[model samples]
Target: MATTRVVLITGTSSGIGLAAAVAAARAGHHVVATMRDTGRADALRAAAAEAGVAERVEVARLDVTDTASVTECLDAVLARHGRLDAVVNNAGAGYVGTVEQDGLDPVRATMEVNFFGVVDVTRAALPHLRASGGRVITVTSVGGVVGQPFNEAYCAAKFAVEGFMESLAPVAASVGVHVGVVEPGAVASEFIGNQGIDLPALLDAAGPYAPALKAYVDRTLAAFGQAQTPQEAAEPIVEALTAEHPPFRVQTSDRARAFVGTKLADLDGSVVQHLTGSWVA
Candidate 1:
């Protein structure tokens, strides 16, 4: 029998985080599922029990935005498991607003939760991960590559996270810790419905943008229908976390790969168009 790996996953209260925790437990990994509120983690515990992997999973409180929580959780995990195999920084939220209309406050708030929050958790887990030669898997998005319309704030945050993770990849590898990023396209997670639209108030208070902002936001929201389920997009996350040698970036779902391909093509076209009068059609 194979030895069970110890994995600490954030944002396990619901959606992709929840699904990933369940899947990890089923795969014989001892999963530490961390959510902001333990009271809301009943579903996670229930799911683990239903999968008959309850004993392999533990629900804990870990608010990514809180540095103390990250430290506490990592310490608890190390104290209990003695070895850390992987850390999944999956806690994040999407923001719906244009760059100008939302103002810097909204963008900063988004960064605090999505980018800095991941940093906090990863840094806390690094010691344990390095000791065990473990892996760090960050759940980024397709928006991290190309700027999305309505979610410019969210996109900016994800873009920063992508940059940070890319830069840390070699650093982690040097310490025998592998860093992997899962760029999921539009996963049908509860993120959209749970997103805070109240940022518009801050935008109003900060000032306003041109009428074009509304058009941009509307165009972006229309793309939400293309999202796949969290389960579908997370399969690669599980695979990457467990693989002996994982790729730096794993594009989850067909839409994720398609989005990346389109972005590459667009970049190439722009370069060709700049050099020649005719567009690369």
Candidate 2:
């Protein structure tokens, strides 16, 4: 049997976070499932109960964008559990649109949630992680490797997370803390469901970018039609948490590996540019 661990996962109200939390608990680990709103935890609770790991799953409220909340949540976890062996930084918001069309505020909001939120949580968790020689696993996306059309802000934030984790991994390892980033491609989950985007209204206000936006949305819809389930995408995150020596980077699926591989091997960047470029054209 795998050794039991105390794991804390953020954004567990839905999607990869929810899946990872339950999967971790089911794997004989104690899971602290946190969401911004505790009231929205019914689905997660139901899943955990059905999986027979409900008692091992503790639901908490944590708004990652707030520093006080991050500190408070971690403190409560330590107080309640005495130790946190792993942390899954899976809370994120998705965005669609160009920088010029949405202006800076929307981009800033995306960074605040997707990028800064991860940074704050990771930073806050590092001390505890180092103490326990724990692991930090973050669910970034293939967008982090291959920038997608109509996802400038989202990609930028993911890219920042990739860079941040990549840089910190080595330094963190020196203190016996393992760090890894999980890259999933086209996950069929409700990340931007919270974004409240109106497709018709978005295109109506596109101005000069309407054609590209329309094409991009059409292609994205088809891609998501065959996207991996949240459970599938969440697997790699759990692996990183449980592995004795997880690598700094991990792609969740074959499609994700191939997609991220293109960007990794592209010397002049023409191949990926042409590939993603076609989706918009």
Best by lDDT: 2
Tens-digit per-residue lDDT, 89-140, candidate 2: 9999988888887789989999999999999999999999898889999989
Candidate 1 lDDT tens digits, 1-281: 12568999999887899999989888778999999989998888898889899998899899999898888888887788788889999999887655554468878889999999999998888988888889999999887887654566888889999999999999999999999899987677778677755535634543444344454444445655777777877688899877878899989877679767766678555642342222111
Candidate 2 global CA lDDT score:
0.91
For all candidates, the clash counts are 0, 0
- Candidate closest to the true structure, highest TM-score: 2
lDDT scores in order: 0.81, 0.91
TM-score per prediction, in order, is: 0.87, 0.97
> What stretches of model 1 exceed 4 Å from their correct place?
1-3, 198-222, 268-281
Give the clashing residue pairs of candidate 1, or none. Answer: none
Residue 135 alpha-carbon offset, candidate 2, angstroms? 0.6
How accurate locally is residue 25 in candidate 2, as Cα lDDT from 0 to 100? 89
